[model samples]
Target: MEVRRATVDDIDVMAHVLATVAEEGTLGTEPPVDLEVRGQRFRELIEGQGPSAMWVLEDGGRVLGNASVSETRTSGVLTLGMAILAEARGRGGGRRLLEAILEHARSQGAHKVELEAWTDNARAIALYVSTGFEVEGLRRNHYRRRDGSLRSTLLMAVLLDTSEPEPA
Candidate 1:
């Protein structure tokens, strides 16, 4: 699989991957919406020259996953978001996507990259931990599922600038 910066042309397939995962009631907290709506939102992100970078994993002509990191106003801290197609989950696509995003964030001078995962998502949590993230805290009942049940979230982060140790 090849990983590269995402462009507007990738919006359609990216939306499909996100919608599929959202419909599966995993990862994302956003409710599934029309594909065109999702594509439009993705277009805004691609066109906006904001403090964010998005990448897509593709093999042949198919999109396998999407990953992004956006800088927060809290200087030096960037938030990460990623989603992989169910069929591509265990094939190292997620890890490669995350590694690429982390490198992009580091290149942009970010000192830390943070992300949240539903507490019940063991596979994702394992991926994050294995990829160098540490659970910083738990956000109690922060996410509501499609079924109307609330789920807790795990606040995790990876310090990019390893020259200095994270504050205790």
Candidate 2:
């Protein structure tokens, strides 16, 4: 599998992977993903000149999953999210994707990268932790699902700016 910066040609497959993963109720987004809106967003990130960027993992030239870091309201902080097809989860794709985005974040001068993962997503959390991410906090009953049930998430982050402050 190859992990690379995504282009306009990858939007559809990326959205498809997202929607497929969402159907399992693991990701933040729900099924029935709005392709047009998602495509537009991907287009902006790909075509625009900004710190935010997206990447995809492909095997035999077919996309298997995607990850992205978007500029957050706080400067120097980027929010990250990723989704991989269920069949592709066990392989090292997630790690590779995370590596790519984290490198991109550092290159863009981002101070930190943050993400939210469902509390039940133990595998994902483990992967994040192994990659230097720390569990920051948990948002209890934070998100209400379409069926009216609530889901909580664990807020995790990795600080990129670990340098010592200048002495006065």
Candidate 3:
């Protein structure tokens, strides 16, 4: 498992990881989420963001997951996003990716880290909880599902205390 900063070349694989993790592949069986759009987002974030870092986890040169940190200077917090290939879930890939991004957040002077998780994704919510994330707030109808139904989003946060131990 090698985690390295992503380049523009990593766009395709990163798109695959996102669509897979987001369940776009299994839900609609239609066109996967626009790879071109995702690729462009990744490109811009990797090339032009401040207090941010993007990384891809590869095994044998194959991308297994991707994660990024977007630091909000106003709030002194870093928001992170992690997407692991569907077939790669529960094998420690997500945990590894999150840990790596957490380290990056600490280096960026972020005392708090946050992420948004779909309320229906119990597995992901559990993962974040186990990683020390606490549900800070909720955003209703944050996203629309394939059935055209609205879903809530959970705002989770983890305090990154480089000075003392994280809350238990």
- The TM-score leader among the candidates is 2
Q: Give me the runs in candidate 1 sitting further than 4 Å from their true place.
A: 162-168
Q: Rank the candidates by lDDT, best first.
A: 2, 1, 3
Best candidate (score: lDDT): 2
- Runs of candidate 2 with Cα error greater than 4 angstroms are 164-168
Angstrom error of the Cα, residue 6, model 3: value is 1.3
What TM-score does candidate 1 reach? 0.89
lDDT of 1 by residue, 1-168 (tens): 888989988998888888888876676646566898878767766676655877899989789999877765668898888888888779888889888978877787888899888888999999999999999999998766667888888999998888976599
| Clashing residue pairs in candidate 3 (N, C-alpha, C atoms within 3 angstroms) | none
Name the TM-score of candidate 3. 0.81
- lDDT agreement with native, every candidate: 0.83, 0.91, 0.78
Question: In angstroms, how far off is 97's CA in candidate 3?
Answer: 0.7
The true-versus-predicted C-alpha distance at residue 27 of model 1, in Å, is 2.3
Tens-digit per-residue lDDT, 1-168, candidate 2: 989999999998888788888889998998788988888988888887778899999999989999988886788999998998988888999999999999999999998999999999999999999999999999999999999999999999999998966588
Candidate 3's error at 14, in angstroms?
1.1
TM, every model = 0.89, 0.95, 0.81
lDDT of 2 at 85: 90
Counting clashing residue pairs in each candidate, in order, gives 0, 0, 0
